[model samples]
Target: MVDLPGFKTFGAASMSDSHLAEVTGVSSNPGQLRGRLYLPPSLQRGAPLVVALHGCTQTAAGYDRGTGWSTLAEREGFALLLPEQARGNNPNGCFNWFTPGDIARCGGEAESIAAMVEAVVAEHSLDRARVFVTGLSAGGAMTAVMLATYPELFAGGAIIGGLPYGRASGVPEALAAMRAPSGNATELAQAVRSASAGYRGSWPSVSVWHGAADHTVAVANMDATTAQWLGVHGLDPAACSTEHGAGWTHRTWRGADGRIAVEERRIAGMGHGVPIDPSGSDRLGVAGPFMLDVALSSTAEIARSWGLVAAAEVRREPAEAPVRRRLVPEVMPANDTAAPPASAATSGVGQVIEDALRAAGLMR
Candidate 1:
């Protein structure tokens, strides 16, 4: 419960028990940036942390409200940090993943985001071993950049409806790649492989979720991302399939080190929106129970398998209640406690008895 200076809480009932704070500050270069922090009501000394980044045309609040991730964090006892993009950073409020300096190993938006993570971790009780990063669309691209540049900082990442990596070329090339039609799947796949090859450490485990019908980011990006991870990790691409669910398919690539696990989830008939229900106006798709269930389920599975979450705890049941009429200890005979079987009765005898009783009582 460390008091964050200049941070304020939002009194929404869904997160009333959590500590919410918004902070605006200058980074190392004294450049201004804004971010939001969601701390659960009861956190361990060093709780796991999740850094959630928003997509285009979305702010921290909009992202939090749209995804309902804050509520999940509150209930699950994890801290959430959201780094916002100011209009000055990108005209459309998107992180400049296309900018040359921004795409580099330690420069531009990548550096600022890394700074933000460092700031929050320094001020909070974050477990260094259990930090995760996730984002959508442009935010997802930025997430890829973070994974590439700051591989040591995050345990893993989830990229939803995003590209494989950001380009260090010019914005025009980046924009062309961003707006490229869905047909050029091969070239896009090559680009992702090239981008990910630059990472220095053991590749981080990654989970990608894409809609089969997503037009904005294009569903083909999932194929490209999967190919990139597989190629880099020397996995056989032919082994992938769409048989996981009726409207869902997945591919997993394992690296030689056995620590890197890359997977893709392709949802049938889905769009560029976060696949959730009861969604806010800012969300991309219809919000419903399914979206949260899917996201949380995926997250939990990853955490549980990766040792990010603790193992299941066992509990003992209460003993049976004492018998209403206890026999005297000296006179009682030992007998099995199991229930006794009743003698077989004539078929329809109960019905006949009930009919007779009803007739005698003049009732049906």
Candidate 2:
């Protein structure tokens, strides 16, 4: 982990470190996932919960620290579940979204994640109806897996620079899936439907985000992702409403219930990272590898859509220590020995920048 030299977590100067409370040890079942939970100072009953997944080569702590989910949770009086992928599972630390076993229901990482969510709900005074999930890259892909496999689990979710679930079974196919094939949107959505059979529940609303210039995961994947959710929600992609953001565009399609079922974001001139707002306004995470200092904040945008925060209203509560406990993995099923998802290897220069961004934050 790089100490970001000269950089402090936004507003860390005035806030006590204890305000960012986290407890390590909750188990991600079936997969025995190593995971942690962030707590807010004041636990309001029925508060919203967010399950955040990190991108490749990033740890749960690294992603939470950089993205400021803990900070947001504390302020908004919500809880967080940040799950980490073990190195043994995938050397690159990317979620195994491409693996068939991992993406399937009641099995592999997907089932384990659902189990983790149950763990969080069991212990806390949370509103099961208000759960949401989001992730970046491979994490983003896994977010799609969780939302699709267990559509009843989430109210909404956001995917940043990710592809549709069930589109690939391995690395080679994953690479090919990024090209956004002819009429790819239609194909991707159908693939999601086939992922789970005989499921008739309200599909989660989706927020799809991708930089127009993202080279790591082609922007085309965003189109396919948008199509996947729109198809699930049965909304016409062409008949959508549009909202403009600084350096980005948001397109939404309201469902029959008069609520947004699908929304897509196109960040202009951005790259392969979660967009961060450098200005004090809308700041959630730090600027580092895969964490860009763009004019928009995906975190803030996502939270508002989830109904966790209000427009122009960001809260910061007093410091409160969190409950801590050690994780105890349940006995694995005999037939399941698959490892958690792994991260993908990127270029040397990209590694340097990512490491430097991490280092800069750490150093401060």
Give the candidate number with the greatest lDDT. 2
264 Cα displacement, candidate 2 (Å)? 0.9
Clashing residue pairs in candidate 1 are: 276-287, 276-288, 277-287, 277-288, 278-287, 278-288, 279-287
lDDT of 1 at 13: 33
Task: Give one digit per residue, the lDDT tens place, for model 1 in 1-364.
Answer: 2211111211123443234587434355222446778887876768888888877655676677656667667667888888877766665466766666776655577777777777777677588877888887778778877776777778888888777674335544554454442334355435544544465565567778876655456676676666655654556766544335434565666665654477787665665545553432222322321133222233444444456556543222222322112111111112423222112212475744442222111122
lDDT of model 2 at residue 133? 98
Best by TM-score: 2
Ten contiguous residues with the weakest lDDT in model 2: 323-332
At residue 136, what lDDT does model 1 achieve? 79
Candidate 1, residue 185: CA error in Å? Answer: 11
User: Per-residue alpha-carbon lDDT of model 2 for 1-364, expressed as tens digits?
Assistant: 3223222222223434433334433464666566678777787888888999987667787788667888888788999998877766775567888788889887788988888887787778689999999999888989999888988889999999887888877655665666552346667777777777767888999999987877657788888888888888778878998766445677899999898889988877776678776465855777666777765678887998888889764332222322111111111123433222113333576564453333211111
lDDT values of the candidates?
A: 0.58, 0.72
Model 1 accuracy (lDDT, Cα): 0.58
TM-score of each candidate structure, all chains considered together: 0.67, 0.79
